[model samples]
Target: MKVLLILADGMRPDSLTNIPQAQKLIKESAYTLSGETVSPSVTLPCHISLFHSVTPQRHGTTTNTYAPQVRPINGLCEVLKQADKKCAIFYNWEEIRDVSRPNSLAHSCFYAGRRIGYKEAGEALTADAIGYLKKYDTDFTFIYFGYPDWAGHKYGWMTEEYLQAIQSSWDNIEKLMAELGDEYTYIITADHGGHDRTHGSDMPEDMVIPVIIKGKGFDAGKILENVNIMDIAPTVTKILGVTPDEEWEGRALI
Candidate 1:
């Protein structure tokens, strides 16, 4: 089965209360509101951990800066490509480009969130991603929305503005699902949550993330347990019928 990953950066599970789309997803998917992200809980490091299925200590990217891994490990895209699966990525953030190695991706689309602003970038990227998904037949695709994190940094986490960003991200999610959901299993999550105006602390607000799995294999309306961001890659590889990297520390959920 093809898998599509959608991420809303720095979104807190508690902030989904008022979003109609998000509420519908929570009731219809196998979900965990208290899934944990790797500490540092910063964007780049947590994502590296997610894709590589290991801790930042193992991957060696402790900050937003892309540090070369001393002992590199295959990420999701790399592993998928090795199995002859086509992979694509659509993202607003630039730093996240390093998550997958060169030649691993069959296609990639990026909108500069740093220059045009994350909100605008997310909007444009979502439209383009939807178009691409409708036209293409990629085995694995990842779509990233930077709005929530940018909003969290600008207006405190859980504030109206930040919640609005989360809602906006969900609007895009709903659009994609409405059109192309039955063809792909959708996995939605966050790299990290936030507190006040900043994150990276080990506080629950920063570390706890929400994970929603919606598709044929996952049980609808079921509450999941012991979920972690690193588990994502293992689960994806499992769904795609590919072997996980030997160094991965996470176990597949299904």
Candidate 2:
């Protein structure tokens, strides 16, 4: 099965129900899995953990920089491509553009510079993702939206504006789902959640992330437990019948 991995950076579980479109997706097509973030809870390590199915320590990245390459020695993109599945990415964070990882392997990759509520930038990222999704006809696509997390960092997690930004993202996601139809296994999740909207530290809310799995063949109403961020890659690889590397720490939800 194809994978559409939606990374709504820094999204809290509590925010899902607050957005009508996201809420409908949660109710109709998906189930939420409780998960955690790696230490330092930042974007690079979190995303590396996601693709490699290991902690930041295992993946080798501690900060957002290109050095200290820890995890993702064998990224998900490489695995998927080896299995004859096309892969593509659309992301807003510049830190993830490293050549050592999945971003480099995408059939196409797009990024927007740092800044929250930059409507033109958001539109650019969204348009790129949609374009790649349509153009590649890939079996797997990963779309990472950074505004919610950036908003949370600047405006705090519980603020109305941050929530509103999430709502707008939901609208874009809806467009993606509608266009893609049932051809993919869509997984919507976050690198981490936060209380004061801060991560990169050990905090209960900051470490916890929400996992929503949906699409044509997944089990609806399936509530998975003990799912770590590290498990996501393995789960997706397994479902797609690809062999994940042995260094992965996560398990398939199914």
Candidate 3:
């Protein structure tokens, strides 16, 4: 089976301590990396860096307003599909509104309804993810959870609301992972870290996010330093016995 990547948008390194479930998860099967994100930590550009394995400036998506373009760079989904493996995305963002893109990425794509804020929108996203859990038979799944980041961006990572939101998201993720069991390797990461409710800057707090991996397939009990967010795509494809595109700037962590 391929890996399952859960991307929590706008999540911070400090927020990791608040979620007991995630903390326990880290203690168990965690191969955590202290990852640095590309500049412009907002959703669209950050996601571009994540998928394309390049800096936001190189990827030409330096802001939320830019339409996603994937030329001169290929993402994990493209690599997986070319290798004859199944890939799917349960996305809740507008950048992927183009139906053709998701269809090309996966055999099936599930775009759940969107919401305004993190908590308000995530309940629907979680349920949508749970439903997709039961239906999809794909080898790889990418689920995006966007509350902690929302709270973090609006209320700061150290605030009570952000902590609570982080915990809640982790609780939901635990349920999903428990149900899936060892059928898939789970990789949880954030696009970027933030502080004082802002990203898109070169600050340490905004650049470093946590990369948590679990499941029997993972090495476990490992810590990586100075990792790059772009590295995840290559690492995931490598685990599935596939080669990443030449344009990708990451190397396999495994």
Top TM-score model? 1
- State the lDDT of candidate 2 residue by residue for 65-174, as single tens digits: 74555223677776777777777777777776652343335565555646544444566777777777776667777777788888888899968877876887787788
lDDT by residue (174-204, candidate 1, tens digit) is: 9889978687889999999999999999999
Please give the lDDT score for candidate 1. Answer: 0.93
Error of 2 at 211 (Å): 0.5
Query: What tens digits encode model 3's per-residue C-alpha lDDT throughout 164-191?
Result: 8787778768877877777788888888
- Model 3 TM-score relative to the real fold: 0.89
In model 3, which regions exceed 4 Å deviation? Answer: 67-71, 96-102, 107-117
TM-score of each: 0.98, 0.90, 0.89
Provide the lDDT at 210 for model 2. 83
User: Deviation in angstroms for 101 in model 3?
Assistant: 2.8
